[model samples]
Target chain A: MQDREKAFIRALVRSNATFGIGDDGVEISNFVVANDAFFEDVHFKRAWGSLESIVEKCFVVNLSDIYAMNAIPRFCLLMLTLPTDFKEVGKLAKIIGNCALKHKVKIIGGDTIAGDKLHFSLTFLGQRQKSRILTRQSIKKGDILGYMNPSSVLTHTKTQAFGKNTKILKTALRFHQHRKIQSNTRFAKPILYPKMLLELNSIARAGMDISDGIFMELPRLSHLNRLGFKVFKPKGDWLYAPEEYQMLYAIPKNKLKKMQNFAKKHRHSFVPFAKAVRGKYRESKKNWHT
Target chain B: MQDREKAFIRALVRSNATFGIGDDGVEISNFVVANDAFFEDVHFKRAWGSLESIVEKCFVVNLSDIYAMNAIPRFCLLMLTLPTDFKEVGKLAKIIGNCALKHKVKIIGGDTIAGDKLHFSLTFLGQRQKSRILTRQSIKKGDILGYMNPSSVLTHTKTQAFGKNTKILKTALRFHQHRKIQSNTRFAKPILYPKMLLELNSIARAGMDISDGIFMELPRLSHLNRLGFKVFKPKGDWLYAPEEYQMLYAIPKNKLKKMQNFAKKHRHSFVPFAKAVRGKYRESKKNWHT
Candidate 1:
């Protein structure tokens, strides 16, 4: 399936499209269009989460793609296929409506049908200033690469604290005592701040959201730009773990200080991890002492 | 599921979107966004058709929505979920690519995943000239309602003739001798001619493609406009049967001659079936002697 996915992407590249398959979304003139699918067993197990949490996660997953391109998500169309036994139709609508309200995106139109299993797909429409749109193919040698560390977004202890303090998280906390299950709700939620991306858009040369782990995404960036990546520290399992909603980006070496200042002003932790070089694609296995 | 589908659509209507839930697509600025879903066992059986036909049908289904609005479909994004046994991934891409090429619509970006069943969802992005876009809510009393009859698109004998002559349909002809099976491929295809719509766009008040039967859709239009439809002839099974790619439109009574001339110039069959009047929604049960 992975190889076929690549082949499918390569076929589309010949169409002279503005963005490649690995990019968060494709840019058409001023509009950015993208879609994401969430299946029952592949993406979520009905026993692992509530219906509301699953629906909310679906919207956040699609939004992550739009935000990765430094674009503002304006509208969404949903396609849902439900099993015959599923009867929470009105509740599902309310949850989706609430999510759209929170993000200020309108639910324009969609199709609904009955099927064997539950399937949720959302297509998001967004826009970015012509000068601010980002792509992964623009990286150059000597550029500094950075990533939004999963630990920086929310650690297990912080999630537990938030679950104990907030009323919404309090309900999720009662489901299990283990840290993994307790933090599941927070993990499903996406931390999106489009304003921060807009602020760094001028300095960032290339960017993509890390939905398929850092190792998988780094190779894509390297392959697209025909350059190699040299990570500073890469000994931890976190480097290879699949983390959703985190962003990986490349910045010019000369703009590192400005990038750091912008992150500090926005209270975001942008960790620099690698540098692009003229060589075959390879990752550092040892930790750096910088 | 039908009740829930209605509930979900009603919930979205509260957002004050540019178009209603029953319309083919929603108008956002000058572009229209729409989506449709096709499930494996529900919409098609793998043993009954080829992969190329299924993929082509998916594209045509989405295209119908764009054309119903008198809009030009410019771009598409696909989200596919396949079972583990499905291995026609590359062939699927080639067929979709060819369809997009034929329609001049670009394949932008999409997501793919493995699931319990084969699911295909297509999202279309289209543009409409400011003065040309039409919507169902714009219908008025005394407007003449017209439809592209299923027989006009392709009849059973015509489909068999096409199947016998075209190399592509020869493979489909081997499946079953039933006229239903012979006409299935043609039914899956969409008849989109934007030039004809452009000619009628200045005068057509409201329009929609009929995926659900005419009997079901006519009431929706009447309910939306707070009017009734008086059908002249409605006894044929085609009137109550669900047709995939036919369109139903409302043209001003004064513009009937121009609409007829445009349809003839474009080599299209536009059949007048009903008229808008001040009353509750109802359908004629008897056939008319035209």
Candidate 2:
């Protein structure tokens, strides 16, 4: 780093403000709750992404986990790795605070480190009702798989970052500009729907958000119970490309209809994708997504 | 990535194992963690610093955080960027796991990504006591500053990479290598002292372990509480030299003498750094590692 940059960083460190860039790492507490997001470049970018959208995107990424577990996020630890002279630190922080307020989450303890690329990882601690908790390993075979939020966040980014150096900022801007020109923007609504997950009660059987390659997540969850899954994902391009934060739940076949009703009540897209099976992938049909 | 390397990645992914590296990115869960480390080339050369020591060094650097937070760390996430695969990753992972088990921690999650230089990071998480949380913001002025482990983790890695690199592997078998090395090896012990923290119950006003620079952290904790810190960090290079981990707490002055009793019980060190001040840097203290 040049002398000037070093000086800038030192000032950021000495700002005596909430958070800043520092060579000396964070002064954190113990028995703490934190979460970090290792965002793929296209998942968040600044160029055209409105500061609010970028901020909103970050909240969506993390709260997805909180929702999947049917928990209420109490505090968040935001760890950011961005380029020197990070263009939007202050704005992003503000947006995060606002979103947290909307969701009743607090920005308690976290750090911001400098990296060559933009990787925003936020660790959040949620308050679960002890026994009312859910985990991937607890999933059972033959449980009906009830999926929600048909237009997952994955579909959004895949469309925006189909090629080139796609990043969070560019993808966000793509949505923003599209909304501005069309004079209609429903992005925020879908993004906020995950917050309703806390009300899922006990219906969300073995559950997980469609992060990573959803294709990969399915078989992995099934394996936890030595079972296979027969998924009937929507037969469209949307099934393949997604930024959609789709919730994959393993409810029993008898409860699938009830779960769909719950989704309609909350107005989330409830799409039944697969059924938990009792065989290996080789023995089952593999023609889906192909 | 060539075809074979791509296949290697595919197989790692197909295993449905956590922490695989691919286009889909790392897939470790919340129970998993990884951290990053950026070091000066002169900081540790391959000649004097055995690959085992480097591996141990990286583990201490991050494992310290896991212990500091009073979390039961189950795994370690590693990403080391070096000129070549000069170090055996399996050996590194095993050594880290051994260290974790010694400390009652675990090595359940990790992701390794190559980089242009010898920069590495680990993002790991541990289970913290859900309650009895600690944070830097809780420190008020006039609190006692205590040192759990006053030592530093400094070693010579200067002649290694520049000289007969990794020649230690070819040297006549060293007899001492078989001895059970101390977990408190000067370079590793400073960071692994979780026992001291377990003693810090309800008394600590504000605290954070010194990893960056203790002097740097004093001001940080001060800033976090919107207060000023008065610290007597020794008067020389000790302030800037990289420290593995050292406790820096501001407890109530009334508890100052209690630390001595605690010290006797634990054989720990107690350093009476300056009082928690209410203003900016003192004019007389310009040697603040600035």
Which candidate has the highest DockQ of all?
1
Write model 2 residue lDDT over B16-123, tens digit each, in one string: 321222101111223323343433232333443455566566666566665554444654333333333334544444554555456554332222333333444555
Q: What is the lDDT of candidate 1?
A: 0.68
**Model 1 clashing residue pairs (backbone):** none
**For every model in order, what is the number of clashing pairs?**
0, 49
**What stretches of model 2 exceed 4 Å from their correct place?**
A1-36, A40-42, A137-141, A149-190, A199-201, A231-235, A282-290, B1-96, B106-191, B200-207, B220-234, B237-244, B249-269, B273-280, B283-290
lDDT by residue for model 1 over A36-66, one digit each (tens)? 8887756655655667677777887788788
Local accuracy of candidate 1 as per-residue lDDT tens digits, B187-217: 4444555666666666678888766567777
The Cα RMSD of model 1 versus the native structure comes to 6.5
- Cα lDDT for residue B3, model 2? 28
